[model samples]
Target: MAQHAVPSAAAPDARPATPVRVPVREILPWAIFAFVLAGVLLYFVGAEQGATSVFGGTWIHEFTHDGRHLLGFPCH
Candidate 1:
């Protein structure tokens, strides 16, 4: 009597997975929007006081007071 080899039941599939692609053109507008949004937020938190005030009062500064101190901005 001769012994024969047996195949394993846990063999991997032969199909390959497709890779995902991100195009720069599609992301540029969103990147620019985010940049502008960040700039606006930074302005409100850092420079929304004194002569550069946008709302003509301390409302923005008061609202972002804690954040200013946290980010090390001169609030006083």
Candidate 2:
């Protein structure tokens, strides 16, 4: 009678994952820029209209009409 060897149940490549460090100084400017950009977009999509209009005419309203309705801003 011949005996066969059984395989071991050891795990392979069990290394821990290291977290990357993000510095605030490097990301502050970009964050601020993005914030400002978002504010401007919000204004255009939500407010840019008559009485509170920055530029004259219905062009801005027409341009952002769908966006206004999409954002739940009443244009009509």
Candidate 3:
């Protein structure tokens, strides 16, 4: 019987291992930034410009006023 020794060599540099990407850890700051941006856009867009509301019809008017009240904004 003949015995053969195994060769131990590093992998070829031609094909490198894929790099691992990690997500951002500080997401709260980004979320706050987005919230502020949306508010600024909404302010410039003007809420009263639209006749149609998400609530629809008479319920829409009531819902809008109630939402404003809940948010501490005086609509009426």
Number of the top-ranking candidate, with lDDT as the measure = 1
Better of 1 and 3 by TM-score: 1
- Cα lDDT tens digits for candidate 2, 1-76: 6643743345365456799999999999999999999999999889899788998888989999998888899987
1 versus 2: better lDDT goes to: 1
For candidate 3, lDDT tens digit of each residue in 1-76? 6643643355354455598775676777898899999885454333532452333345444545655556665545
Total clashes for model 3? 0
Q: How accurate locally is residue 13 in candidate 2, as Cα lDDT from 0 to 100? A: 52
TM-score per prediction, in order, is: 0.76, 0.75, 0.30
lDDT of 1 by residue, 1-76 (tens): 6643643455464355699899999999999999999999999999999988878777888999999999999989
Order by TM-score, highest first: 1, 2, 3
Superposition TM-score, candidate 3 onto the true structure: 0.30
Summed backbone clashes in each candidate are 0, 0, 0
- List the candidate 3 regions with Cα displacement exceeding 4 Å: 1-11, 14-24, 48-76
The superposed Cα distance between candidate 3 and the true structure at residue 7, in angstroms, equals 21
